[model samples]
Target: MTQARRNGVLSDATFDDVRRDAWPVVLLPFGATEPHNTHLPYGTDTILGSEVAARVAAHCMAAGTNVMALPAVPFGVNTTQLDLPFTINVMPSTQLALLRDVIRSLEPHGVRALVLLNAHGGNELRALVRELQPSTPIMLAIVNWWQAADHATFEQAGDHAGELETAAIMHVAPHLVAPDRHTWGDGRSNPSTLEGVRRGVAWMPRRWTQATVDTGVGDPRAATAENGAAFVAQAVERITAFCCELAVADPSSLWAPAP
Candidate 1:
């Protein structure tokens, strides 16, 4: 256990340090490789997920919590965006299989919990977690990092390559963002004709090409690094707190007592 150099990042930790350290909870940042309008890079989700997970893990380690951040899974359910160039889509079944293997690998290492720090909105994983929880000894949990924080700061946090995401990328990796704002796309989506779908009474994946002009669902013109930093900080604080509590929680009695 190299406490002096510990950062709770599994990729950076040495084998000797890992074998000796007590990792009660491990965070797996899951993201997708896809387009984020014309300004942000294709790897925005992956980068954001990895960065947030790393920050949370570092905070946890600093606070003496036994938590580890795993390397992010860079591909996600991009079924609707497959028509777009270079967009990679991993089927739900494949995701389940991959996650199962990850859990199996951790079981022998004495890991007691697994937190899926999901960054991609398309990765519908709640059902997957429910399906796997009963059979696995490792406690399963998921957190959509975007929804982890309040969005009162931004005017409109678009669904995709929009204000919130663009701001976030600007904060984390400014180099990846295109400096020429003129080339940026206005993330306006074409709403469905069906009233049910438009009103959230029904559900269906929007066709990327038909949904928006450039795959963006929100406006990114007002995005600023300052706002992004503030949002990310809030998310990190909330998530770190949750991870810390989960690390020491009794799995058998996770629910609250009779009220």
Candidate 2:
């Protein structure tokens, strides 16, 4: 079952359903199309972003919240990874424009809330939100799904194609994971830039080629599907609670000087 009408999945929902129901908030899944080391699929970020949004949206719908899951934006800002093969890059300006158009589309439909469930580290939507806030009545939120919670469920929560991602893919789509053919990641860092970044004294995009030959940032040796399942379940629980709150929050009082 697509769970279209039940969950308010935009692509799956019919035009009539969308027109009939007043959705309180729409989830915009932002992801990246890039290399996640040599072992993981290129669509790792997309898969994570879309799946998290879908799952949370489903939960909210089951709880009778007016939440809708928009279609996943599969391309993200991958300027640093442009040299890598087939790493589709969308500049920050393009991202802002894309967000503007999406927001514009939602305005006519009476949807005033948008939650950006971002799965890619390279794609940051905060700046876009700051720029577009004054222009619209929409309440925008940018959530980095991977960092939404402390994933202590895993023994090692590797950043890139490390334990965390590998385990996540295992639980979400085990058929796509090939651990047998996987190369272990070490979370290597460039000596020239690593210290500066660690000290917070300088900032620069780390080239994948310069970071590691495999483009991996963490070790996946300790990753397990069981751990992934726990992590994902926790994330869903946390995000669902937030969504439920957003569903009923008064738009006028969202920012009242934080008294």
Candidate 3:
């Protein structure tokens, strides 16, 4: 059964009782409502993120562990998609507030730590993480599911709607992909790292209009289900490992620096 996939069934008899074999851990799919090229669905990001969360939760549970995967949070900070129609851009503060509220709401109910399975590249969650550290004092952390897979196996590094994402989408939801959009589109046009791929490097945002014109970055044609399977396997393994690690970590210890 899906961890927290709530049906109309009575709440008391569901997850809290039926799935008592494991500890209460939440796997959240934080996604964005934005454009994902012509071929891909607007919910592609969350779809993948939710897929990862579900698979990872299953893996963890099978290993004699307890975990619950919550339904995905589909709306995120999609400022990059602002110009596009139907692109809902929630403010950072709003996102943070929502997260904080969720954390607080979930904490008292035995939901210890959270695995933030995020998908949107536009959402800047690092600052939100910092802000929540002191308030909730839970074992909270972020995990961008798209980046959890091994890049070497991907045959394409991380980028928007590029090789990795395309392959992943193809793997998870092949029927949703538009073949014409995949075949007709030009090669990935955007430089995902306009400011360079270094911390504190010269910063310049790549405007979606000019940089991501086709609404994609990497080569989608290069994608395949095989690559997506590998990515999913690796991501599930990695995400499960992270979930296990975070399960035992103390929130106070987060402040300590490693040498």
The Cα local distance difference test for each model comes to 0.92, 0.84, 0.74
For residues 1-259, what per-residue lDDT tens digits would candidate 1 score against the true structure?
Answer: 7536547888888988788888999999999999899999989999999999999998888898978999999999999888899999999999999999999999998888899999999999998898899999999999999999989879998889899999899999999999999899988889998899989999998888998998899999899999999999999999999998888888889888698
Model 2 lDDT, residue 188, Cα: 61
Which structure is stronger by lDDT: 1 or 3?
Answer: 1
- Give per-model TM-scores: 0.96, 0.92, 0.84
Please name the candidate that would achieve the greatest lDDT relative to the true structure. 1
Can you list the residue pairs that collide in candidate 2? 187-217
lDDT of 3 at 162: 72
Estimate, for each residue in 141-255, the C-alpha lDDT of model 2 and write its tens digit.
Answer: 8888898767677677877888888888889988877667535555565555567777888877777788776788877777888888888888888888899888888888876
lDDT of 1 at 49: 95
When summed lDDT is taken over every stretch of 10 residues in candidate 2, the lowest stretch is 181-190
Q: For candidate 1, list the clashing residue pairs, or say none.
A: none
Among the numbered candidates, top TM-score falls to 1
| Model 1 ranges with Cα > 4 A deviation | 1-6
